[model samples]
Target: MIPIQLTFHGAAGTVTGSCYRLDIGDRHVLVDCGMFQGDKTIKQLNYQPWPFDPRRIAAVLVTHAHIDHSGLLPKLVKAGYAGPIYATPGTSDLLQFMLPDSGSIQEMEVERLNRRNQRRGGGIVQPIYTEQDAQDCLRLLAARDFGSWFDVTGGLRARFWNAGHILGAASIELEVETGGARPLRLLFSGDIGPEHKALQQEAMAPSDLDIVVMESTYGGRPRPKLDDSQRRAVLAEEVTAALAAGGNLVIPAFAVERTQELLADLTRLIADGTIKRVPIFVDSPLATRITSVFAKYLHQENGIKAGAARPFDGGNLRFTRTVQESMQIEQVTGGAIIIAASGMCEAGRIRHHLKNNLWRSNATILLIGYQAPGTLGALLEKGERVVRIQGDEVAVRAHIRKLEIYSGHADHDELLDWLTNRLPIHGSLMLTHGEPDAIGALHASIALWRERAPQVIVPKLDETYSLAKAQPRLMKMTQQSRRLDRYAETEAISGHDWHNDYARLMLQVQHQLRTAKSDLDRRRLLKKMQRILGRGAGTD
Candidate 1:
């Protein structure tokens, strides 16, 4: 029997990039080609060479349209992966706008970085992939319906189950043929959704699997189970409080599901007199385009009738589609609600909105999604008094509030219930896409299952396992084949990196200088720091 090995290229120790490689004999395929988010070191992995040859991969199966799960498709194509990229129709439609937008973001960010580097006498760096590359990759997307088995390669077949996380999110099931009496059945739980998720039905999947690759995004975090109405009520309270504060409410939202869900709830809140009607601006052009995609499929799923009232439409809703329109939003100082994308506040117009509103004492910044560590959202959520935005220091005086009920991932208990429902596994259960604490907590919880639980494995970044019928065994790799050094990977996944430290250091230095009793004292401090830096300049 040929050995089947599974390798996790990303999202092993951290919950950002989510690529997985499946090797069935000589042929290999990818489960996802997501981009790395969070810390700068982790994001640099996007620029690193693929550990495996992309040209050899027979096909790619995409789980969803979120950038963290599907953002690197263009980079993969640019690197010579010409095989068909399989996705659901909804995922395909959403990615038509998302990938290009991601490419554009990359281009714009790199352009700005290059200007800074040029000023500092550093080398220029190109974007990982351009918008044209994203457009070119779109030609390879092949849309497939849910619940239907399709041929992936010579000896492999795959199917998609509704994940209930986002519009086109799915948990993929794969059947790999070996020489045994039956094929190896494996399921990949792609970002399972919580119960009563907005605009999504309950997540569904088939049972009695051999192996399951599941995400542990919210492993140790358990939230109150709120239905649609209850969830809306929670949001209504935040909106009312923000408006009552006499300043604009700025929400950093994901352009895909989170933004649409917020709009739906906000629209309802205004119509029912739960909250006063305010001019709500969807300030992301990508979000404006994605909202239309949701409109197309909103009634199709979630049991909403095709002729029913539009949940995302309202009299006061405005979508800012142009740069001019987005800039015009800066003129509104109060009594308006602004929603922008790049949920973690890593990039996009959200930074601009934050820069404008974060310093206002009356403004409220509502964070409705997960804030990955080291991102601007996480910094704000952590109560950082000052933050650097687009090279400028900004004091954080605005109200930073978080709504945990809106997260799409299933919480700890919910994840356990989801896993327990897929009981009687014949082989190992591997957990990925979580940090050390969350994964460790979930692992400890699974230990209570005693003999009933399958062998649980928490694989690390770039780790490979041999999936034999008896049991899965870890495989050793040559040093040359690993994408990142073990220590480097560990540091990258540790959340905050040197860039975060540098930002904090700069802020501290400025604060100390401003608070110094005299200019002479500040000069002495500066000289001391300069002397220390000079002494260590060439040591490393």
Candidate 2:
């Protein structure tokens, strides 16, 4: 019998990228081709050479359309992977705009960086992929319906079940031929959603699997269980307080489900007179398009009821689609609400909004989703008084508030329950898509299971395992096959790299210069730093 192998290319130790490779003999398939979105070292993986040959991948099974989960498709296609990307209809529709938007962001960021590098006489860099590449990759998407088994390749059949995370999110079930009496059953829980999520049902899947791969995003953090009314009440309190602060409220939100959920809640809150309706500007063209997609799927059973009021419409909602229109929001000093992508403050118009409002003591910055470590959102959430944004030093005087009630992913208890429902796994259980602490916590929790628990394995990036009827065996790789060096892999997954340290050091230098007693003191400090750099430059 040919040996089957599984490799984790991303989202093993960190929480951003989420790709997994499954090789059944000579033919191989990819689960998710995601983009890394944390520290610079981690994000650099996007520009590196593909560890495996992209042309050899027969098919790709996408669980959702989040950028981290689907953002690298353009790059993959550009690398010569011409295979059908199977996804739910909703996910396919969402990616139609999302991927191109990601490409645009890449081009814009690279252009700005290249200009700076040009002035400094540094080497030029190209974008990982362009907008045109994203548009071209869309032709490979093949929409598959939920709850039906379909042929994926020669010996693999798959089905999609509602994961309740977002509009088109799903938990994938795969049946792989093992050349034995029975095939291997595996379930991949792709970002399982919380119970009573804004517009989704609870996550569901078939039980008694052979293997299970699950996300542990909120593993150790259990949120308060709140009903829809209570949840909206909490949101009402935050909105009222922010507006009463006498300045605009800036929200860095994910463009997909998070934006739609907030709009729906805001609409209901305004209609009930819970909060005053101010000029609400969604300063993201991608978000505006995604909102329209949400509207199209509203009448489905998995979505809103038949006659519910339009959540993403009505009120003083304005979608700023042009550059000038997004820039116009800077003039609004108070009593307005501005929501922009991306949720983590890594890219998009949100950075502009934060740059404009963070220094305003009266303004409020509300973070309503998970802020991956090393992201600007995490820095703000951690109460950093000063931050560097797009090459400018900005004082963070705005009230930074985080509301986990609106999170789409399942929390500790919810994830545990989701796992419990999929019990009787006949093989190994792999936990991934989380930080080190979260993964440990979830593993500890699972160890307390009273029944016969499956053997657990926490794989690392680029690590491969040989799958068998018994426990899977870890495979050793030679230097040539490794995608990242040992030290680089550690640094990439550590959530903080030298880039973060350099930014902090620069901020410290700036603060010291600003607070220096006199001009002479500032000059002395600069000269001392220069002398230290001169002494160490050649030695290192």
Candidate 3:
């Protein structure tokens, strides 16, 4: 038997929370433990318990340091997972700053919730994890260089290549040798970035794979072909107009990769005198710290090595680490450039800057990344005349500019190009990590590949299909029955109901069954029910 079972724990339908679990015999490895973004229902999913025990996970491989790729590491550690967490050297350094800061924010949020509940005569609420837990996770990190394959489990070797999405982003390839002589190769495109980014090298193309899992972040949009030079030129025009007004320019950027890329571009622009030399302030302490870490790892890749010099040092660039320094930005009467986070303006120092400058006609708000719907940044990007920030309503007088060219993710055409380099002469293909329409667009493009060699599959969230192995007789069992079988001894001794009680016992299983059909639905339902009612008493 080929000892392998794959499950998409997260990043199935939505873009955030990029976790995929692969089981090879007794060893289980999870790829990327990210946090869910936007969609309150999905965000609420973060608070739920894991489907499997965290300790059962042998190790974790992080694709990058973006919050969506590495946010949940601290939570995993807090859950008692004690195993090596693998990442590129740059990702490891960035996480040292990001995870702890995220932990601090989570702790503060929980504290605030507890205090507010106390005012309403309720008890305290514990945070998901503390900064201490994050620190502990950091201790588990083992940094590795890219392009090197390392053994993860029995016959499973993994390697990473440049994804070009962010500073340390990568696409992963895992070769799992079955009990047979032949090994199955799987490729995971971890948020494929734009090909010709100024801050990073173009994404690499894989030669071959048995199974391919690709991201579709920009899958919904048409490919707007623009290289790094084209992107810089477009940005220069915007910066020129914004500075000519002699007011502040606010850029809401992700602290890790986007900020660094923006800084590099600004450096070149200033060096060329295309954009005037003005005070540029980076206001987020976490971003400022991560910037330093990025500097340390510049030699790891061709992109960073090319722009080896400290782009943000000397000149007018200033890193504002203190709240005092952030506040002092208001005193700048002349034109200034401010880069802050969170990228979508959902939270962070960017909100303070927006609040201070939104009503100023001379100020400009530059949006550089995707804004999840319902976020403050999305509203502003959509051209709302006014928005509320920190309880106060502010009029929108600042010029709102969007330079979509600065996106790190690949566009539709670029995605197709990357796929063309990997598809077999006559094999199957699978597409994941994109929205419905975008997935459809990719599906259409897949037809072009099918003309050459037909066999492409696009799966919905929670959907499962059998691999090449022969079908298992166990597929006929109900979900509840499977659940009871897994925990039969405990349920029997504890006298736990295997029907009604189990229905309430496992919400994750219930959710999985709600949309499942036929054999899959039957198995999931039986397992859940039998776990509650005890054995041999149910219709399943």
Instruction: Quantify all predictions' global Cα lDDT against the true fold.
Output: 0.91, 0.91, 0.75
TM-score of each: 0.98, 0.98, 0.83
Candidate 2 lDDT over 1-540, as tens digits, reads 667889999999888789999999998999988999998999998999999999999999999999889999999999999999999999999999999999998999999999999999998999999999999999999999999899999999999999999999999999999899888888889889998778888889999998899999998999999988888999999989999999999999999988888888888888888899788999999999999898899878655431246777784999999999999999999999999998999999999999999999999999997999889999999999999999999999999999999899999999989898898888899999999889999999999985767899999988899888836789997797777788877887777788999999999998899999999999999999988998899643
Tens digits of lDDT, candidate 3, 1-540:
655666666666557777877777788899999986653345554776776689999989998888888888888988889998988777787888999988887887787678778989998877767888899899999877789899877678889888887777788888877776667777888988776676677888477667777887777576567766777788899999998887888999998878888888888888877888888899999988987876776665433643537765656889998889989987875588999999989777788889889999988999997876546787788897766675466789999998778787888888877887886623346566665567778778777654564366665333344444422111233353222233442332222225324323454454466667677777967876777666566644
Better structure of 2 and 3 per TM-score: 2
Can you tell me which runs of candidate 3 are displaced by over 4 Å? Answer: 113-125, 299-308, 425-428, 462-465, 469-540
TM-score of 3: 0.83
Which lDDT tens digits does candidate 1 get at residues 187-255? 999999999887787788888989999999898899998988889899999999999999999999999
